[model samples]
Target: MSRHRQRQRERGQAAVEYAGVIALLLFVALAAIQLGVAAYAAQQAGTAARAGARAASMPDGDGQAGLAADAAVSSWLTPKTQSGSCGDQITVSVTIDIPQVLPIFDFGSARRSVTMPCD
Candidate 1:
């Protein structure tokens, strides 16, 4: 009787341990997802900045260059403005929206800036 009671008590212990392991795995998975999203956003920002700088360097006009840059960037980005002297150098800036998964956590805007000489 004593041995049987001990075995019964130990039966639920496995379930409790399994639950803890499962919870830990879930937390790790969430962290990996968050990191991936952040890296993707950062890559997008860099691409947008480079595109914007190249556009601004064109000799034609700022309007077309800005538009082209915006198109090159990810849809999450809203092209702000391209400014600088005509013959000297031009600067292009793009603002990207960061998606928030957690209610308590807020990822701020991602911005990229690039400077290129006018062509």
Candidate 2:
């Protein structure tokens, strides 16, 4: 009876260990997902800057730079675009907030700049 009771007491040990490991695994997965979101946000910023610069470089694209940048970014992200100097070169800068998948850390924002020759 004593040996049977000891065996019964240890029966759930594996489950307890697994429970601890599962928590760690979940944290790691969340971190990886957060990193991926950050990368995507940075890519989106670059795309927005490029599109805006291309628009600003054109003869008829002076006022359409903002629209082109807004259209290039993903709907889920809001972009802040700044354009300057369209004489010899057109420069556009785009900033986007990175999504926070994990509440433990603040990922802040991503920024990109592009310059294109005026056409």
Give, for candidate 1, the lowest lDDT window spanning 10 residues. Answer: 77-86
CA lDDT, every prediction? 0.70, 0.92
TM-score of 2: 0.91
Instruction: Work out the TM-score per prediction.
Output: 0.76, 0.91
TM-score of 1: 0.76
Query: What global local distance difference test value does model 2 have?
Result: 0.92
Give a tens-digit lDDT track for model 2, residues 1-119: 69999998899899999999999999999999999999999999999999999998999887777899899988999999999868999889999999899889688999999999999
lDDT of 1 by residue, 1-119 (tens): 69999898788898899999999998777777766666677677767778767876777766665676667766755655445655688777766666665444466767777778887
Clashing pairs in 1: none
